[model samples]
Target: MTQFHAYQNRNPASRERYPYLLDIQSDLLGELRTTVVVPLCPADLAENMRLSHLNPSLEIDGRRYVAMTQELAGIERKRLGKTVHDLGSYREQIIASIDFLMSGI
Candidate 1:
């Protein structure tokens, strides 16, 4: 597992709106039992209501998803399941969104 990699959202209750959880925790912290993640929501449902930079548009599984940075959380690594997609290409945006959430820049 690595930063910017997305995994299937294990909780079925929220899966329709957020189908994936993008791991943002650093590789150096891989040993931790809990992994930090941000839910990736359907663009049409989340984008318009989000702040700029705080919610980046991402492509996953041939669809567009909005990174719900404000929903950042840490869950058990085992709950993340297998990696469904690699979001490494959106590294800068992902980092920036987190930065914006922490520092407003």
Candidate 2:
């Protein structure tokens, strides 16, 4: 999957809490079997949390979901379900968040 493509979470174990998984994997690794993703859980669940840079708030399908960037993971490409939408509008914020995670700048 291309970068910033939000996908439905197929796993029932965490579906309620994390309805979407934003694929942050670069398009350059198309041949790779695994893709990196960050879960998007309901922002209400994280109402008390204040780590904006680490977990930016995002709105998808009319619901507010927080990007759980700190929980980034690599899973099988097939694991991601149907596409939610392209997060092109949030690209800069996402990139900056990733940069902050890596360099703290």
Candidate with best TM-score: 1
All candidates' TM-scores? 0.95, 0.93
Report the lDDT tens digits of candidate 2 across residue range 1-105: 888989999999999888899988889998999999989889999777648888888888777888888788999999999998888789988887888889998
How does candidate 2 fare on TM-score?
A: 0.93
Candidate 2 — which pairs collide?
none
Model 1 stretches with alpha carbons more than 4 Å out:
none
User: What are the clash counts of all predictions, listed in order?
Assistant: 0, 0
- lDDT of candidate model 1 versus the reference: 0.91
- Model 1 lDDT per residue over 50-95, tens place: 8768999999878999999999998999988679899999999999
Residues forming the 10-long window of minimal summed lDDT in candidate 1:
44-53
lDDT of 1 at 22: 96
Superposed Cα deviation of residue 46, candidate 2 (Å): 1.6
